[model samples]
Target chain A: MDVLRPSPSGVVAAEITIAEPMVRLRGVSKVYRSLRRNGTDVEALRPLDLNIARGEFVTIVGPSGCGKSTLLSLIAGLSPYTTGEIDIGGRPVAGPYTDLGIVFQKDLLLSWRTILDNVLIQAEVRGLDRRKAAARAAELLALVGLSGFEQFLPHELSGGMRQRVAICRALLHNPPLLLMDEPFAALDAITRDQLTLDFQRFWQRDRRTVVFITHNLVEAVFLGDRVIVMTPRPGGIAEILDIDLARPRNLAVRDTPDFARYTRRIHDLFIETGIIKAE
Target chain B: MSTRTRNHADAGHPGAIEGKPAGGLDKGEAPPMRRTRRRGAGRGFRRFYSVIATIVVLLIWEGGVRLFAVPALILPAPSVVFATLWERRDLYIAFSVPTTIEIVIGFFVAAVAGILLGILVSFSSFARSTFYPMLISSQLIPKVAIAPVFVIWFGTGLESKVFIAFLIAFFPIMISTMVGLQAIETDMVKLFKSMGASSTTTFIKLRLPAALPNIFAGMKIGMTLAVVGAIVAEFVAADRGLGYYLLYANGQLDSPGVFGAIMLLTVIGVILYYLVEWSQHLFMPSALIRAADLTQATM
Candidate 1:
């Protein structure tokens, strides 16, 4: 249990000394009060501490009941935490932490807006310079191979393409932190793999500190610098495994023994936690 | 295939009518291609069929009245109705102008007030609690019953008629707008917050555009109701307008005159409804197209 606890010391010693971690969660927890008068309160996440360094990608994996999403929400400051403190870029998060990008399972693009306009919404809302933001939006869309689709509406695009547009929307502002909640979960196997590959390239170009949540064990291992495996209900970190694989890994790396070993370890943890039953 | 065998096969099949091959060779075409072609042709065919069906009904009525020797007072022929409409065009047009004005003014006022109230109710819990139930109860009270009260209060002037129309038209708009504003996904709201959007920014950019489809739907319903409301108000008390004209014609036992006024009323109602629809198309073409696509997919 002591070894599983996430510590700043476990990260690359050189990077830690350079600057403070991008995100710091100290004994953060969430408890949702029941809407009904007599209904029981739900302890969605147990108190836990974590440190995410700059440019590092940390992926959280858990079963449906686990509060992995709750943790992400806490960091994003989209919801109020029940207890403990969360710091992003050394500032205490009071309301929504605006200097970050977030992507949910659904693309959530406005149906009326064109692809270019959709990506530019982050800029529009944030009050960034439109000309610069539009240029950045074009570049980001091109990065995700969505250059020609700028004029099309969201409904015209396929699900995967729309997700790609969403990614571009998220990245348009060039936020230091990117939080994704199962962004690829809705796509088909082939589309998911392609996105995973493209995502690596996107991450490599400008490595933002990312806290991604996913249910897929392989995706967790493949994407994370450190994979945070969470327990079901009152979700706390079960273990955080350092993904020792090289950067910019392709789909073929998923087939390698090293990747398999990491995924296998997470799978074994899920079974031990009774999230899965081999029998 | 034999009729008996075909009938036996189609007994439980939902698509039996549509799936039936028009000619023997139609079965050889790919099912998907055949279905697409049929859908494309079906739209034009349906429109043509509707026109033909309306003509047939009119023809039957005209022929039946002549054949059965029915009295003109009882049921005027289509020809007589149209002829009457043409003969008294000036009177009908004069009456219709006031009716049209009442509808237009009432509808516009209702739209503005309903939308504003919807926004208030959606944003403020206090407003929601206090006004939502009252709004529902107000809807329950028959507008017709209270219409005379409006006439008493505002008098038999245009105000009373406009007020009545405004009353009838606003409920659906307010309710639908409220529902539309509240229907946004929680995650989408969170995303907006994360972007550091102010509440006003969120309302204008996110909530307003998202709610347009529902708002337009409400407006369409309200437009038709507005026409009804104006006429009802005029029925209660009016010196002018189509409703007063209709009553005047009925009192004189001038059946053609009554029918002509009614024909004018129908024209006004249909034109107002289409005006609302056209505005929706202009404002949100993509939403309209998407709605069409969704209906197509379901079909």
Candidate 2:
């Protein structure tokens, strides 16, 4: 079991003030046995321990088979951890919670619905008032800067715009915690970087906790309040770097020395294993 | 589910990259010196030309037939057919009313039955296992071969024709709808999972709404097939209706009337087809807003 030995047990010695700590995982691991290709059992995740605070932005970065997504499934309670426990808000997570909302790599907007209708889906799913949710749907469209596109169908918007609608959907129910899995990884580079700031700007407004998963180091560092770096498969935490940079971060920061230095330091940590060497 | 996302991939129009900045360029491209409706207008023009060409073809057909003095036996010109239809108004009206009644009632029944069965198969994997094979086998057995039996079973009445129409129209809707319901983005389902949506919520919002576009497609196809099926069944046995009228005209050596019968059916088919399209436009998302962008994805 790889319980991330706190980077500085002494520095964080005082009781963690963030009420509820949101989510806590202990000794969580996942094993997937393939039935089609010779029935080989693959241990997708190694035992692990981690916690996300009530209103912190954390990003998990790794390659395709590194169990990053498996870990996410465990946290989201979509998939069971083979041998461990996950707790959310001090209660052992038996299954998924209504208090959490998620977004994915594909926007997955319903074709039959307008942008307004898609956003209302979250509240409708939770059995909240549909009329009320319908209004909140409009509010969220504006929140994501998609006010006029309330009637736009999923097929009618650009890739970036569709994703913005997705973000509105995730935030519509106002879940205290948001879990995102490579939501921007599918978009073009420019769109991706811009969306990173756009999402962070929204996160800053409400101060809700966010647990995001991404493989792009620049995106990881750009969005996270605390960047949690994981090693290759059977993965465990390798670095927990707290980003202390001042906020209201925009595209202009991408070229700054501090951004470069922080990026390089994290790059060195990953490449130390020789996978991503000096180049 | 494989079905959910797969449906999205297979859908006639995927919902990304709608209208552009007037020209045919992708939105991501840099703003040009001038907004040219070159691509957009070009497509519109193509559609315009097609309508014009169709009208021109019809006009020439009518003119050539009229000027050549072709006998009504060889070819009843469009005007003669129109005149005949108007003169025999009561005969056409009586026939059309019953035919339309059978079509409407039969269509509603088939749609409801097919959708319910499809949902049942989708929700229960066990039922799918047990029934899908039989379902497929039933589709393969030609309804024409079984029309006599249906006549015996339900009589040479409206019920028999309705039954045949339902049979012919059920499969496409079933398959499309099943595929649509299953066609869901896993991430979206998982999102519901994260938000604590139960299986029902996943089905209602993520699956049902996602499936609607394809469902509409299936319905359109099913509705069209209903008309053809009803006509076929009527051919097998019936006293009234256009199908029977066609047979009567042939027996009586009324060649113009026979051809008129065929023309009447063609018109019915075209009208039914357009009705489905128009309804889709009203109930489904506004195709106009998306058409400005989707109009370009011609392969």
List, residue by residue over B45-142, the lDDT tens digit for candidate 1.
68688679989998999999999988879988889999999988898889889999999999999999998899899999998899888988988999
What fraction of native interface contacts does model 2 preserve?
0.43
> Residue A33: error of model 2 in Å?
2.1
DockQ of all candidate complexes? 0.21, 0.29
Q: Estimate each model's TM-score.
A: 0.88, 0.83
Best-matching candidate per DockQ: 2
The lDDT per prediction is 0.83, 0.74
The best candidate by lDDT is 1
**Reference-based TM-score, model 2:** 0.83
Tens-digit lDDT track for model 2 on B181-217?
8877677677777766788767766777567666767
